[model samples]
Target: MTRKRVLCISYQFPPFAGTGVFRVLNFVEHLPDRGWDPVVLSVLPGHYERGTALDDGLCARVNGSARVHRTKCFQGIDAMLSLRGTFRGNATPASAGQGETAGTAPAGKGFWQGVKDAVTLAYRIPDKQVGWLPYALAEGVRICRHEKPELIYASGGPWTSFLIGLALKAHFHLPLVIDFRDPWMNNPYDELNVGFRRRVNRFLERWCLRRADAVIANTEPLRTLLADTAGSGNKCHTITNGYNETEYVGLKARASGTVPLVVTHVGNLYGKRTPDSFLQALTRLIDTGRLGVHEVAVRFIGHVDEARINNLIGSHPVSAMVTCVGVVPKNQALKMLFQSDIALLIQPDTRLQIPAKLFEYIRSQKPILAVCGEGATQELIEAHGLGVVADADDPEGMEGAILDVFRQARSAEGHVKKDYMAFEAGALTTQLAGVFDGVFQSSPQMKNG
Candidate 1:
């Protein structure tokens, strides 16, 4: 019964979908059925075909249970202008069962593929965690001397996969676990769009969370803002971002509630998670006609910043009841949040607390309106009674909680049971395998001790 290896360094996995690499690729694709053996160290598909998430059956269920090293995604030209603003603001990073040239990558080329894309920003391919610090410290000293791992999980988009698990925990002093999917220097937009290369990435996230043994955080208000900026708030914890019941029953068997009364909203919109005070209270109930007998359709998918959505349609007033589907494809944004009827989540009133798309907006229970700020994403949408909880920094209490969830969808008239589609992504990856067995059984008995 000896199995607990884990070496999961990530740079947005599963074909690199957007945001916090699918909770460390479903904890290295279900931490080898509770005994653990994950050895992932990602970033491949020639410049992350728009940030990974192409399931060839989730890459044969994570290369048939972990040991999936990729390395080789160097696009620097500001990561190719953030992948040409996520493929000209349509955010989807490939795989519609791959066709269209197996999705992305032949956008006109020549001159030896533009001199190997200008020497892939100086090629270093140490198993491709980009910015190859001595090829990620020589593949973190060959995966700490051939996966002698006990625990060394690290994640990030470009925060250099937490300096490749802080150089394999400073070369073998093991049990490390640093995983801050966001929040380095408690980001709330300060300092040149949080750059000076994130002040050398907050001095490598304070030397890997003061030399980690455990620092997890995905949001209990970013584990109390990274334990009050590593002054040690009980060494930071929280393991959130769930919803998987076999990828929400394969997204409710190829979704499509036909469309219309939609009112959706997926991810990536910055500086106060902008929805501009619930589109200025749905443009004052659609220019005072008070959306009576509802025919609403607000959508706004992802990365749509057409000048911050034409400044949220010239400062709202139902900006013609917006529908700017800019960045689709996370299976068409979960089949438009499984035929949405209202899942409006918006946050950033100082990173309110949790927002890994609020666990796929609580499994798309299809009634969330949350405007943010009252913490723990309004107590996990009032402990999953899931529906409305406004105030993206208050506007008449976020327009009286979106006109009381549009008066409970104009006095209900149908069937429902949407606890965000009753969660279960393998029981939320076995509650992140009980937070990696309460952080390697409260580490410090160490493999490097």
Candidate 2:
């Protein structure tokens, strides 16, 4: 069978390790099995912003499976930030895997910082990754002309990929599929975009949604939200972020809990997703003599937003109990996740979004202690009986949840078994391929082309 070609436009790709990379990475790997050839278009490694972690293992996994074209980006912001860091006598993009306490103390939220943020918000129209548009657009056009791809699949957080896809669709008259891993305008982190910038984002979101032939959201709630905006509810689908079961082929959960109960969070903590409440709960547990100071160990295995996370952890009494492992390779991180007694998730204020790490946690079968309010994350955890959930604001509840997990681990019953075949990457990719089939068959653009 002749596989239909899809030009996958994603700003986040392998080597640049983060939650953002996993969705598209999985799709790229599995799309071929479903009779779709994925041709990925991404930014070069140098174009990646500061604090991005590289995973060579992941990069190698993609090699030869599909053709990947990486283009250079205009690094205006990177240059400016690097220059600023040089002047400030700090390292350029703080080195990863510096062990626990690997961050500098957060600078004061002064007038200058406020001004800088305002200026950045005003200029970085779609996002900071807007710098990649021109280069990606050129490369996309070249690919369309040479490779003659039948469809365009654009995944976003760096929503620039959508714009690139839109431009290509306009030029080539091909079917376009846009995937939203996170909300653009309705994003809970309003601090990043507000006033005029926020309004501009809403307009762009509607503009792209109207143009795309199919829209995919990683969460069902997000699918509903996008469906309302797109005004074509039927076209919007929920093909969620799922685990790569093949990655867990030989991995096994620990037979028993560690000496000091390890509560591991495998992803980055930034924005409003801080460990403030979790740390507070830990402190309370120690104060009340529920959990000893050295009895429970909390590990953050990925990136930690220097200012927000470190400053908070630095002053906290539970700092000694917490370890930030910075960013490790994908395999190492998964090993850490499986070996831990409990997996900690600090998801607050985001209702529609579910972090990619959640699926992996499900695969690990380790008890998840999610400090999330009422949303998709909470609902999934509760529905599956995965573990415990405590709202971030409820310190007492979080403390209790942690204590409960500790006890369960101590009793050697922390591992959970749940039916998650629906959350597997290959299954999810089959759904994506089904979407592709419908779009290709129904698309007037493809017919005309």
CA RMSD for every model? 19.2, 7.4
Q: Which lDDT value does model 2 have at 201?
A: 87
Q: Rate the local accuracy (lDDT) of all candidates.
A: 0.65, 0.84
- lDDT for model 1: 0.65
- For model 2, the superposed segments whose C-alpha errors exceed 4 Å read 79-119, 257-260, 286-295, 303-326, 407-413, 445-449
lDDT of 1 by residue, 216-334 (tens): 77667778767766778765777667765555565652133433466788876766567767776666666677563246778788875657666655855455568778776676787
Question: Model 2: what TM-score?
Answer: 0.84
lDDT string for model 2 (309-356, tens) is 567766656778777789787788999888888888989988998988
In model 1, which regions exceed 4 Å deviation? 13-20, 25-33, 37-134, 144-262, 268-303, 306-341, 344-362, 367-415, 418-449
Best by lDDT: 2
